[model samples]
Target: MTNRTFMTVEEVAAELDVSKSYAYKIVKQLNEELKKLGYLTVAGRVNTNYFRKKVCYSEV
Candidate 1:
């Protein structure tokens, strides 16, 4: 995977093997959660580490 601080919607879709629309929804949901936790969020991207953790992507 390329080194990136945030993942775009396309990247999220590709990584999760889901459609772009679904990826957008997922990003929105995750962003909302982050906002609730008082974390700043960008509009069409998510923090890479947060995404991996939320999706349970192990580094093993």
Candidate 2:
């Protein structure tokens, strides 16, 4: 229904009229949880991506 894009922690904070520190904390915690589920990771400073599913390959 919307064309908005993913937002960084600071952006979310500004949009929500909340503290940046709180946003940063929530983002950091969520990132950790995502890592545990193997659905997200950091490509660089503050870069995170979520895949729809897991992928794996094995060599015989």
Q: On a 0 to 100 scale, what is the lDDT of residue 18 in model 2?
A: 83
TM-score of 1: 0.92
Task: After superposing candidate 2 on the true structure, give the runs of residues whose Cα lies further than 4 Å from its correct spot.
Answer: 1-5, 43-60
User: Lowest-scoring 10 consecutive residues by lDDT in candidate 2?
Assistant: 51-60
TM-scores of the models, in the given order? 0.92, 0.52
Candidate 2 lDDT over residue span 1-60, tens digit each: 122334476654664568988767656765676678675544221332221111112121
Q: Residue-wise lDDT of candidate 1 within 1-60, one digit each (tens)? A: 797889999999999999999999999999999999999999999989889989998552
- Model 2 Cα shift for residue 16 (angstroms): 3.2
Residue pairs whose backbone atoms clash in candidate 1: none
After superposition, the stretches of candidate 1 with alpha carbons farther than 4 Å from their true spots are: none
lDDT of each: 0.94, 0.48
Candidate of highest lDDT: 1
